[model samples]
Structure formats: structure tokens, C-alpha cells
Target chain A: MTVFYVITKFLTFPGAITKALFEHIMCKVLKLPVEDTRCLRTDEMCGHIEHELVERPVAGFWLCFIPGLLNFLLGMSLSLFGVINVYCLGNYTGFIQNNALLSNLFASALTGNANLVSTVNFLLPILFLWLGFSMFVNMAPLPEDALMMKEQYKNLNGFLKVLFAPSYFVMRIGAPLERYGVTFILFAVIAVVLAIL
Target chain B: MDNENKNEELFDEASAIEEIEENDQPDVSVEPEQPEQEQPMEPETEQSVEDETVERLNAMGDEIDAEDLGGIPVTPPDDDSVDEETESELCVMCGEKPADKSFGEDYDLCADCRKRLVKAPISFASILFFILIIGVCFFGFLLSASQLSTLQAVSDAYDQAGSNHLYSAIKSLSSAGNIGWKTAKKAVSLYNDSGYLSGIASMVDAYFYDASASSDTKLTWADKVGKGNLNAPWNKDVKKIYSDYNTAMDAYEKYYAYFSEYDEQLYYGEIAVKDVPYDELIQKYETAKQTETESAGLAFISYCEWYLANMCEKGLETELQYMKAVQEACPDFTWLYLTKLTELQISAGEYEAAEANCKKMLQINADDYYGEYFRAMILRRQGKYDEAIAKMDAVIADYENNGFYYAYYEAGINAFLKNDIKQALSYIKVCYEGEYLNYNTANFYALLNKLDNNEEEYQAALDMISSNQAQLSPTVEKYLKKQITAEEMFNGVGNPFEQPAAESEAAE
Candidate 1:
């Protein structure tokens, strides 16, 4: 049992230990029967059990890869656009004399452009990649017995269903809204402000 | 028969006990009567068990007897003592009992609990080790990335500063040697970190172009004279040369300042200085020279006095006399002395003598592009434009081959002034390729555009002129203003030369 627990924990995310502790507490608080508990098991237990094995479909592969690819493309486009703008500005302004007021102003503008592009295009994408990688790591295979046992353990599903159901709405509606709709709205506001100024 | 046998067996076990108890007693104290009574019970039991046992015993009688039993063995009580000693020791980890006993020899660990004890630490350490390794790698990556970013920033700053514009500042910083060099080098290093290799190359170009950036070992001679450390190995000739050079710089600065003020006064129609006592002025100049010359040398003081006297007299001969005196004092002040000699010849209407002196200056400093340009100027003054163009060709070739981008641009301007459009365009192409920035380059391109009747190219050059106007150094601004009218200059231009004009116009 300890070996099974160690192996399962090793395969999970950074906060798996805390998650395991939470699961243990939930089991006790709910007064679940020891016999009904879905405990971590060694591969040897499966080897001993007589059962027909069938391939299970994985949904996370496309979930992770598609978003990762989109983010990469979006970041690349932003970087190229930003660089082009900066290049045009540099060429137009020509040489800025040292210690001159105009030169100092232009220098400040260029520095701002560099910092903005670096943060928005380069840094944000790297962060998204890390988040995507973490999500992929968490999508490991659930055991067959545990999947079967989950049906009997109604509370387990009840708890997770409540926790995860809102995420579906977020992913379906909110993500698209934030990705495109919000961006458009923000841009519109900025344009209006800039026009007025 | 079984009952009789069982009874006899019981009697035999009782008799044997009696016999053993009898044997345990000392021989001297043994009771014969008691033994005789026990012996009867022992025979009875023996006879009942060996009724067939007697027959069996009779058969084994010859083979075995009671005395045949081996000698009685001694037994010790130490086994109980060892058991108590083991029971007293405690387990190292949990201090438990039988469950927490040794797993192996001398290693006290209970079987069930030992697995957790051993595995837990290893598991925790493995997790920690991996986290540490990842953390170090991440830190290293971020550090290098930050360093690269900083380097890029520094490089961009240097590039924006430009070469010719920063020449004087860089030269001043360089002349301070190690102290100045350290700061500039640090700036360059920061630029390199930012991946600005081009900026470093431009800085090196600027360094080489500014002759003043070099050690100016010529100044060290003045140091020797001021310290009066004659015991040190000092070059008497070089010291005398520097002494006169210092004197000339001091006199030039003073006269230039006075002349500039005097010109301003004369322009304002306030020429009160013409009535001032020349003798008193000369005396004051000599007195000031005496005090200031302590830091330079005696020869330097004399040169300053002679120059001031000449300026006061306002006679060409007086200036010539002072120049001759300086020449006699320091024959090795080649560049300055030759320039003075050429000025004297030009003033005396000796064009041939001036041309010869320019040629001599060129010979003395073959790599001096300015010297070559001066020779071309002299030839142009003589109406030998063909010869001047030839000299310009040599200068252009030297500048182009040596990557003297600014010099090449200047040569292009000179060529344009001589009406050699073909040569000027060619040099301008080189300047463009070298990324030299100046208003003149833009103007030359504009002119070429007009000559070729390429409207698009002309507009493009004009746009470039507006863009590059901000980059011009004060010196370049002065030269450009002299070359063209104010109307030709663009609005919003960062003109270093516009200040005086604006001030004067505002006053008016």
C-alpha cells in the first residue's frame, strides 16, 4: 500500500501531497467505509486481478497542444508587428543627438517600445507554455478500478463535478470572450482615449 | 495384564525417583536402610515393565548397566542473564519493544516501521534534490537573459549617441587614460552584453578618428618641465617643443577670446579698445604671462609675451617675428609650426611658399587626411582645380580604404564643391554604405537628384535630410550654416549653430 501511494504521488503535480491529504480528510469526514475507499494500488494488484484490458481515449492531448500552438502563433505575430513598428519609428526619427531634448524624448519612446514588446510578446508566451506543460502533466491516466469505483462513490463525483462544471463554462464562453471580445473592447477604449488626447 | 503392567510402571518411576534422590546424597551420610527399601520398589517396577521387559532387560543386561551412564554434567544459570540483557536495550529511532527490534545485526529497526523510516527520507530528499537542480538551472537562464538584455540596451544607447558627435567627449574621456578608459570600457562592455557589436565598432572608429584620444605623450614633456625632475630621463628636444606648443595654445586661447570680444564691440560700433594704451596692455600681458608661465616653462612665457606684443602692434611683421621666434625656439613643433609658417606665407602673398609648406605638412603626416585636404585647398586657391581634384582623389581613396566614413563624406562634399558630380556621387555611395550621417550627405544626394532629374530620389534625399538634421554635431552645424542660407534650413531642425543667430535676431 505504501509503495502504491509513493508511486502515485511521484506521478502527480507539485501540490499532489496536499491533494492526497485533502482526499484523506474528505474520506474520514464523510464517514466513507474503508472497503469502499479507492486507495492507491501497485501495478502488481492489477496483474493479479483477472480483467479484460481495453484502450481508453485521451482528451487532453488536443486540449493542451491546440492552445499551445495558438499561443505560439499569436506571440510570434505580436512580436513581428511590434518590431516593424519600432523599426519604422527608428528610421523616421533618424539619429538623435546626445543630450538634446528631442533625442532624450525619442530615446525614452524607443526604450518603452522595447520593454513593451519584450514583456507582452516574449515573456507572456513563455509563461503560457509553462502553464500548458503543467496541465499536460496533470492529465495522467486514471486507473480502471478507480473509474469503476467512482460510480459507486457518488460524493466523489458530486464534489469534483461541482468544482469542475464552472470551468467548462469558463473554457467555452469566457475564454473566447476574453480572447477576442475583451481584446476588441479594450482596443476600442484605447483608440477613443488616444483620439481624444 | 495391562493393568498389572501399568501398576508396575508407576512403582518403577517411584523407585527410580527414590534411587536418584538416594544417589544425590553424600556417600558418607547416605542412609542404607532407606536405600534398601527403595531398591525393593525399583525391582518390582522393573520386573512389571519387563515381564517381557525383564526378558528384554536380561537380553540387554550384558550390553548396558546403570554405571554405564556418562558422568553427570555441570549446568550454569547465565542463559537467563543473557536474555535479561537483550530485553533492557532500546530501539534507536522509536524506542519501542519486540516490534522495534533489530532488522539486521546491530541495526535496530522493526520490520514494518523500518520500510517507512528508510523510504520517507529518500523520497523527500529526491524531491528536494530535483527542485534544487531545476531552480539553479532556471536562475542561470534568467541571469544570462537579463545580462543579454542589459547589453542590448547599452549598445543601442551608444549607437544613438553616434560616432562623430561623441568624438570630443570620447577624446576628453580617453585623454584621462585609465580613469576615463575604465568608464568608457565599462559602457562598451555593457553595450556588448546588450548584443550591440556594431555600436562597439562605431566607438572604435570614433576613437581612431579623434587624434586627441591617443596618449598625447606630447603633453608628458610639459609634465617633465613643470616638475623640474631633471634627474629623470627627459627628452630635452621634446620638452622644448611641448613648452612652445603650450605657450602657443595659451596665447591662442587668450587672443581668440579677445579677438572675438573685440569683433563683437567693433560690430556694435563700440571700438573703445583702439584708444587703450598699447604699452600698458603689453605690460599687463607680459605680467600675466609671467605668472601663468610658471606651470609651463621660461620658453613658453617668452612665446606668450611675443604673441601678445604682436597682437597689440597689429603689424604683419610683428606676427612674423613672433612665429620666427617660436620656430627658432622649437624646430620640432612640426604640425603647429608648419601651420604658422603657411599662414605667414599666405599673409605675405607668397602662394608658392604656402603651397610648399602645405606639401611639407602632408609629407610630415602622410596619414593626416586634414593635411591632404589643406594641400587641396592651397591648390584650389592657386586656381589649380585639376591638381586639387587629384589631391581630393588621393584623400577619397585613403578615406574609403581606411573606413573613415566621416572623412569620405567630407571628401564627397569637397568633390561636390569642385563640381565633380561623378566623383561626389561615388563617394556619397560609400558614405551611405558606411552609414555616415550628416546634412551634407543628404544635400549632396539632393543635388545629384536634381542633376539626374530623379524626382523620387530627390524627395527621398530631402526626407532623409530632415531626419538626419538632428544628428549633426555643433562643428558640422557651423560648417553647414556657412555653406547654405538660413532659408534653405528646415524648421524643427536641431541646429547647434542656430543659437547665436536666434539670439542676435531676437536682440534686433
Candidate 2:
């Protein structure tokens, strides 16, 4: 399990770096005492923070939600931008359809029909694909963040638990799913499908 | 290094558990001898309490294992043992603050120090990975942009040359040309400035005596192309198109010139009909047929030759034979030759041969309507009216969405031949409503009306056939002008083989 974790971390190294940096900044901003900030060993850090700061469960919740939510939204936006630009804008500007678009990029040049606009359109999507995939693989919160949120919810009254239910569920489900490398697999499949399309 | 540290931690944890177990043994035995102590306990009770504490410590070890501690084993400090040394322990890292027990007593680091201890420096692999992505993206974008702009320049040159075949060939050759070839771009620009492509077109038209209009433009375009200074590979493809074009043009001129002189001298009683150079004429036809450059002109010339031969009652032996020879020589003209051969066979009443040719057309292109259409006509001529009607129905069903209204007209004729007036009228109405007004369709309208005994509409149909003279072929045009009787114009004529003028022009 640890070996799989390490491999997934390497696969998502860029996302891991961003995650570590974001958590570090969040810890300082919340004035919470830090436990660990290792990129590869991200799982070991968040679990201990709530143990040291028993009264700061709200800060723990924010620490998890903000970074995870931000990464998820950023990943979605970047990938969607690439997809819509290639398919929609490509069609609107009289470029080809998805099946023919890749070949057209080279064929247009071979047939002396390519232009500056087409070149820009071709390269932008590739850059976006890389950035979006990196972000998507690390969008889940750490398992400890979900544990902290669960503990915090138990202490809250009925209305507060209800208010926090969705976040708790997402964190609970997302953490182990991310830890077991499901997020990485999902992102890889999506990238392959998108590239083929 | 990380594995070594984890091994050390595990080893230290195991030794600590051993020490506690050993100390409990001596203390358990000495409990019976310590009755004088302030709060002494019975031996069994003391041992049981010590046993419970060890169990608690072991349970904490399991809990630590449940958490992802990066293989760092930890033990919670024993608050029950309130010794001075226990109170005096401080953080191993940043030695100012007391060691936080969040990671237990075995991990003597404070929270901040624990985080600091595990903080990793960026690996060399990750740094290289990011740099690779950035570099590939930068260079890929740069190269594509450069190639696209170069291609755009080539397209611009084609546009300036008015996109004719000569410029198109040059553009295709230079599209993949090396970026360093400034001479290729310059040559296209020079051709455009000198009005070279238009000059070439004028020279071709003048050579063919097209429309008998003299072109004022000189043939200097040939000289310009020769002096283009293009690289050898680039020059090769462009020269081939020009050479093939000239070869076809010369053949057309020679073939027509000989026929014109033969016609003139025969009219003046200067030569016998047997003196015709048929072998030389066939040679010229074969030469033009080789390049397939002036295909429309060749088809027209072949049609004229067949018409003249048929007028002289020598069509089957002369022109039909020539067409068969051309078919064997030129694969590109197979469809044209096949269609012409089928029509000639039908006119000569060679039903079996015509049917075989129709089957060959369908074998070549199954979707070709010509195959089914000609076969339907052959069936009609064979007096198999029912079978002909079914064939036409199949054609109509297959091409109904494509607006092939001519099939409805043929089906109407088949229905009429079978004496099914009601079915015939319905089919004819579909063609008429579709506005497919031609001499055949108009004549069918008149016949159907006469069969119904409606003299007024029959006369109207006849007047419409005459009124739509411009829509008719030359033979029907003569009938409309009262030069031929209706029977003479209509007898032995199904639909003419020639398409309407607009469609014929588009086909050419």
C-alpha cells in the first residue's frame, strides 16, 4: 500500500507540490501548529495536526476544503476551456471536427492552407491538458482532514451537522479514493479519452 | 536514508517494550517484600495493574499503526509515572518548547519540529519533469506557428496565380519545400507579376482555336516558367503538367486538321473515300488519350466521329471499333466509354451485349444509376414490361431522396407499355409535378391524355412539347419548328443519350 502510495505521489508530483505548498500556507494563516509538510508523505502530515490542536477543528475543515475545492475547480475550468476551445471554436472558425482536427493541424501545413491562428489554436490545448491533469490528480483532501471534519460535525448541533454533511461526505469519500490512486487513474482515463476525441 | 530511519525507529520501539516488560517482572516479585511502603499493594493486584498498563501501551501502538505515520512508531508518554525526568523532556527539534505528545513520547519532537522534520526538498526527477513539459510545449508551439506561417505564404502565392492548374501544381510541390528556399517563393511572385498563368490559358485556347477568337496574349509564359530558377525536384512536377497539357492539345489539333482536309478534298472530287488515313487518325486519338489532359474535348471529338460514321452507315465497324480500342488503352475513361458503348449497342439492337455492359457498370460502381437505368431500358426493349417496371421501381426507391425524377418517367413508360393506364398516369404525374419537363415526358403526357379520350388536354400536351422547344434536343427542336413530323421525331427514340445542356456543360 505504501509502495502504491509513493508511486501515485510521483505520478502526481506537480500536484503534490502544489498541495504541500497550499497546506503550509493554510497552516500559517490559521496560526495552527504544523506537523509535517512533505510532498511525498502528505498523508502523514494532516492526521497529526488535529490531534495537536483539539479546539481548532474549524480551521482544520477550512484547511482541507479550501485547497481541495480550489484544485478541483481549477482543474475543471482548465480542461473545459481546452475542450470547448478546440471543438467549439474550432468548428466556429471553420477548422475541422474532433476526429479530423489533429490530422488537419499537420495536413493544413502540408497542403499550404495553415495559418497563424490555427497554430496558436493547436498548441494552447496541449498546455492546458498538462496543467489540468496535474491539478485533477491532487484534488482530493487528505484522510485526516475528513477525520477532523467528522469529529467537528459530531460536536455541532443538528443544523450545523446538516450544513456540514456534504463537505464531510465528499472529504470522507474523496480522501481514501485519492490515497488509493483512484484519482490518478480517473484523470488518466479522461485524458486518454479526450485526446482520442 | 528514509528506510534506515524507519528501521531505527522500529528497533528503538521494540527495545522500549522489552525494557518495560523486564522492569515489570522485578517490580512484581518485589511487591510482596514492600508491605511497609506508604501505599503498598498485594503482589497479584500490583502485577495485574502493571499488566493492564502494558496492554494499554500496546493498544496505543496499534492505534499509531492505524494512522499513516510514515513508518515512525510512537508511544504516548505515561502520565501515571510522574517522575522528574518525565517532566523535564523537551523537543528534539527547536529545543525551546516542551515536546508535544501529539506523536507520543517516543517521538520527542514538537508539532512544528515534526512538520519541519518531514518537509521534503523538491526531487531532481520532479524538477526535470516540469522542465521537460515546459520545454516541449514551448518548442512545439514555436515550430507549428513557424510552419503554419510558411504554409500561409505558399497559399497566398497560389491565390495570386488565380488557383489554376499550373500554379496549383507549383504550390503543392513547394508546400513541403524547405523553409530556406527563398527562390521558390520568389518564382511564384514573379509568375504572378508577369501574368504568366493567364498567358498559358490563352495559349491553350488559341492552339485549340476555341470559339474561333484570336488571343492577343503572347506565349512568353513558357519562357518565364523555364527561367523560374526553382530547385530541380520542385521544377519536375510543374513541368510534367505543362508537358502533358501541350501533348494533348497538339494531338487534338492534328486529328481535327486531318479530318477537315479529308472532308474538303472529298467535296472537291480530289480524293477517294478509301484514301482516308484511318490508321493515322487512330494514332492521333491514341496520343491524346494517353495523357487524359483534355478529356472533355476528347469525348466531344469522339462523339462527333461516331455521329459522322453512323450517318455514313459505318458506325459499328469504324467508330464502335475505335471506342473499344480507346477503352483498352485508357483506364481513366472507362466510365465514359462504357456508357457510350451501351448506348450504341442498344441502338444496334444488341440487347445481350448491352445488358452485359450495364452489368459491368454496376460492377465498377454499384451506386451508379446508369447501370440500373440502362438495364431497365434493355428490359423494356425486350418487351418484359413487368420486369422493367420493377427495375425502375428499385431505382426510384434507391434514389427517391436524391430527387431522381427521371426514374419516374421511365417507370411511367413501362407501366404504359403494360397497358396499365392508371399506374402509368400516377407515375407520370410524379415526374410532371417534379417539373421534369422534357420531350419524352411531354410526349408521354400527350399519349396518356389521348388514351383517356381527353382531346383538349392531348392537344395542350402537344402544344407544351412544342412550346418548350428550348428544353428539347436538336432533333426535337426541328420537330417544334415543323421541320419533322411528330412520328418522325418520336419514332425509335427513347430518351436521347445526351443530357440536358446545363447538366452536359457541368459534366464537361
Which predicted model would earn the best DockQ? 2
**Candidate 1 residue pairs in clash (backbone atoms < 3 Å):** B50-B53, B50-B54, B151-B193, B151-B194, B152-B194
Model 2 residue B411 distance off true place after TM-score fit, in angstroms: 1.0
lDDT tens per residue, model 1, B74-115: 233236778766765555446564444333355454554444
TM-score of each model, in listed order: 0.30, 0.42
The parts of candidate 1 lying over 4 Å away from their true place are: A1-197, B1-264, B272-280, B290-372, B378-508
lDDT of 2 at B495: 44
lDDT of each: 0.41, 0.55
Clashes of 2: 2
Worst 10 contiguous positions by lDDT, candidate 2 chain A: A88-97
Residue B339, candidate 2: Cα error in Å is 3.5
In model 2, residue pairs whose N, Cα or C atoms come closer than 3 Å (at least 3 residues apart or on different chains), thus clashing, are: A35-B115, A36-B115
